[model samples]
Target: MRKNTVGTAVTLCAAALLTAGLGTASAAPATSPAAAHGAQAQRQPRQPVLVDCAFQPQARPDAFILACGDGNSRLASLHWQHWDGRTAVARGVNLVNDCKPYCAAGKFHSYPVVVRLAHPEPWKKRPQVRQFTQLSLTFTGARPAGYDRVVTLPLWS
Candidate 1:
């Protein structure tokens, strides 16, 4: 009976401290369901991006230039199908210059292709940003003459 009385008194005192918000905070209180969900959403990983030649991170970009020096090669009318941390897939038109006689007089040619961006790594300029480092184009039907069916290129960071 004495032991029961002491335990009961301790329990009552602890309960009173908690009720008055004076209890030790070593143990965190249970979180609400909404708060837990919000925390999960916040913890979700951010999607990777494509960095342009000017060193800018872009998400779901409609167009990306392959040749930054002369701007002779580029992709346009991009329709992105997938974008994630590992890879990104898109269907677009690869506009390349013929450079038949000279680049100064070169004419742009459009070829249908399926584009894939992979090999994501942190950007050198901005370590916090991850960007696609490789680009691949698979010609759907007709491809540029002297060009293979599939071509892979290193993207500029």
Candidate 2:
């Protein structure tokens, strides 16, 4: 049983890497004319985005990971109500793992939430991309244990 659990974790991690590699290049920011001309200052303001673990900039993704190193927490069934150059708003379900005995044996729990992305700043790792620096989730219904009705976390830059 222990061996089976390890195998499952390994398989899930492998799948994540594969999917990230196979993701569409269209998800990356397009090089604008100004960018091509090396006119960094003249470039039009690009839409703020959220980068996945793959480091791909996504304008409005259906799902997003809250924990990047592991697949323990994520936002699912995202329905974006607004996405502008500055901020984003959405309604989604926060799926979190309750790692009881262990992470591999954990059970996932769902919490209905209102999602907000704010503070658009140039990503330190990818300067060309404007990434949302913060994430705020207001739990509309159930939430993870030891969490507040509203939880705000800093997104990976």
Candidate 3:
């Protein structure tokens, strides 16, 4: 009986070692639907926001003015980037250390802030503006400090 018990234990131990050596260590197979969907999402290309301009001549470079929410005077600064032909991106930040009267006081009305390109106009080799076209806006980041909010604007010229 003692010999039989010893032999069984040795066999089990040997089997475990063999499995490990064969690279057959157990790993949970990804079988959940959420896991599969998440993987697929990662593989898919991201989409951009589409906007239509109603203002005359649409909103063009050095002409598109942005009206950001005002009141707290927390607005720190504004930056703009020109893309392709009909798209513009603007980012704003509230660079206030403390929400005091010195930095941010009012927090009610919307402030009309205009943003223009640092580059010269007349897109030399670019296509001529004819009419309003579809636009896309993608917001990247936002926080209480620095430029955390990004706005994509649509303009025609």
Candidate 4:
């Protein structure tokens, strides 16, 4: 009778441990649904803000630099020829650094470029006059051998 009582107590202890482990396992999945929704929210891309091209005439607004704040890429040395309510035509140099090994230790290259900004799409979010929908760039004269003549980039709000 004494041996039977000891065995029964060991069995009860093992059963209690297994029950506690299953309780913790089930609780982990209960929080997973909320975590999944939070991950989905993070996957959405934030809209890009519109920056004004109009700078002071003395400031030499030659280039429309699309730095995007990171300083990785930009348009350099732009001389605006015409800018109306609908279109802007400019001649500039597109300075891009090929960040091969790393960004800080990259070599900057200059290419002669003719940039045109047009296609005014209304920003439903801002509804402003200066906002635009597209920007087109044409590398003229002597660009790198295999580069495209025209590249259209979307400007979205």
Per-residue CA lDDT of model 3 for 21-138, tens digit only, reads 6765355465699988787655431222112223333332332223323333323244554433343455444332334554355233333333322221332222232332332222
Better of 2 and 3 by TM-score: 2
Ten contiguous residues minimizing lDDT sum, candidate 4: 51-60
| Candidate 2, superposed: residue stretches over 4 Å from native | 1-45
Residues 25-129, candidate 4, lDDT per residue (tens digit)? 987755577888787545421222234333211122554555565565568777878766577677888877667678789777788888777775555554433
Task: Report the CA-based lDDT of candidate 3 relative to the real structure.
Answer: 0.39
Q: How many clashing pairs does model 3 include?
A: 9
lDDT of 2 by residue, 1-157 (tens): 9999999999999999888877855478788886777765434237888878888778789999888888999999999999998889999999999998998999999999999999999988768778999999999987888999989998886
Q: Tally clashes: model 1.
A: 0
Which is better, 2 or 3, measured by lDDT? 2
Per-model TM-score versus the true fold: 0.70, 0.70, 0.22, 0.54
What is the descending lDDT order?
Answer: 2, 1, 4, 3
After superposition, the stretches of candidate 3 with alpha carbons farther than 4 Å from their true spots are: 1-14, 20-27, 48-88, 91-157
Count of backbone collisions within predicted model 2: 0
CA-only RMSD, every prediction: 12.3, 18.6, 14.7, 13.6
